[model samples]
Target: MELSEQVAIVTGGSRGIGRAVALRLARNGARVLVNYRRQVAEADKVVALIREFGGDAFAVAADVQDEYAVEAMAQACLERWGRIDLLVNNAGMSWDTPLFRMTDQHWHTVIETNLTSVFFCCRAVLGAMRARAYGRIVNVGSLAGLFGNVGQSNYAAAKAGLIGLTRSLARECALDGITVNVVAPAYIETDFVEPLPPLLRTWSIETNPMRRFGTAEEVAAAIAFFGSPAASYITGQVLAIDGGWVMP
Candidate 1:
């Protein structure tokens, strides 16, 4: 689905799945704002790559968990592009720990990064989205949210929160011509998965029906579909890109 004449914001877009989603949206004809918290160099590279392919994009730094920063990012997009047609909430982090050993900081960090930021970003953009009577919001969730993971209690809880948030928001905004959906991915090939212990990595591969990890680009493709006009009528849905890892 083409996104010609659309404008999009992709959070945590400097690397991994966020990076791929940014590029895909740009390629589909949307002007992109790639949001990053730290990785300035990586953010610059993503912007440069988009420009190289004759796509419009720029990097913006914002700590998404901060409501003020999230508000500013949304305002920046509207100021530059005149409209924000799509929002891909791809910013997230995880610190694995058993429930017993999980410290308050660890719990808050994952929850704020993975869940609270989505709340901030969505609220900041909804006013504009509603005014236009058209918008697409896609949240990047995790399979752990659907089926809990060992040593990832915090992560699982936060991601699980997205399902409720997305569905409720989707219904609230459906009459406004805005759609909200979440995508759950597992065992993805990214920096997040690279550090998995050897035993865990092997087990993951063997357990996956595809016998492989999902690629960032693969996940981005699904995100792009949700962001495009083709998916206008689809909302409040969770599409799992886990290579059949979780199924009916």
Candidate 2:
């Protein structure tokens, strides 16, 4: 729990679950790099919030899907903090459409944004972590990936692929003293889902055993757990924070 000198990079840290995770890590004494794509102001707000809570954090701009950008993001963290102790691959996007109507552009965007970005970020820090013999990686996955959902084929596929990536990287990096894991959350009440149709919103809540939408902070707590030293022995595992929505 004592991550006083750790440095963490959290992609998509501008809002929602990402913002929550960034704050949680900062609260635990990690100097956090809050990564965002286009929302500089929002990302800055996250940094402000962390500072308000007596934490060290700053916002950085980068498109996670861009390999060079991701590498640069990681480098920035290293240059500023001297080492990267944790990474949260939480940048992602989703488009709803039936399989037949899912265009090539849509499919490619989702896969690249959600899955390939994770790989690029992981690769960017792998060598450094191996050299230091220390690191923690917590990927943000989705419940749709565990149980197929209507109109989200692309998102589900990307998240499912993330699970595979988490497992593979965990095994490959364990010997180097790094841990990799995934945290799947179901329908957290955030800006993303706040505008959804009432029917859909109601259904999402009713489907959960708790009969309520999860909070961003609730999801962040689980993610932070996986990145802590206490969870050093847990790797290649999927921890669901979905309120019994998906048992797996």
Candidate 3:
């Protein structure tokens, strides 16, 4: 899908899925603002790579959990590009623990990072999107939230909440030509999954219908689609990039 002349903001864009999304959006003809919490070098690398391919991009550091930082990020995009046509809320983390052993900090940290940050980032961009009467908001979610993975209670709750938020936002912004959606990926081969025990990784692959870990590029494709004009009529939807794992 051609996103010619559009402007996009991809949070947590320094590495992993976020990094892939940033590159993909730039390739689709969108000028991108890659937002990172840390890993400045990695963020710059992504920007450089985009430029290498004749795509435009820049990196911005922001802790999306902070409303002020989130606001600044939005302002940076507006000042640089004059408008925001897409937002990919791809910044999130997981602190796994069974319900009985979960700590308050665990709950709060995961919720604020995964769910509340989306709220902050989305709020920061709504005004600009409304002004243009065109926008695409894509949330990177997980199958754990839909099927409830063991020891991921906090993460599941946060992502489930994201789904609810996306639906409401879709309705609220539909008339403004804005769309909101979520892409849920499972067993993706990213740095996040690289440290898992070998046995756990093996089991995940064996159990998946596709019999392999999904790639970040694969998930990035779906996010890019959701962020493009091709998906103009698709909103309030949760797309699973799990190689058939999310199907009944």
- List the RMSD of every prediction in angstroms: 0.8, 1.1, 1.0
> Candidate 2 regions off by >4 Å?
none
lDDT score for residue 42 of model 3:
99
- What tens-digit string does per-residue lDDT give for candidate 3 at 1-248? 49889999999999999999999999989999999998999999999999999999999999999999999999999999899999999999998878999999999999999999999999999999999899999999999878888899999999999999999999999999999999999988888887777998898888888999899899999999899888899999999889997583
lDDT of 3 at 48: 100
Cα-based TM-score, every candidate: 0.98, 0.97, 0.98
**lDDT leaderboard ranking:** 1, 3, 2
lDDT of 1 by residue, 1-248 (tens): 38888999999999999999999999999999999999999999999999999999989999999999999999999899889999999999999988999999999999999999999999999999999999999999999999889999999999999999999999999999999999999988999998899999998899999999999999999999999889988999999998998783
Model 2, range 150-232, lDDT digits (tens) per residue? 88899999999999999999999998889999998888888878667799888878888999988999988998889898898
| lDDT, each prediction | 0.95, 0.91, 0.94
Q: Which candidate number maximizes lDDT? A: 1
Clashing pairs in model 1? Answer: none
Can you list the residue pairs that collide in candidate 3? Answer: none
Best by TM-score: 1
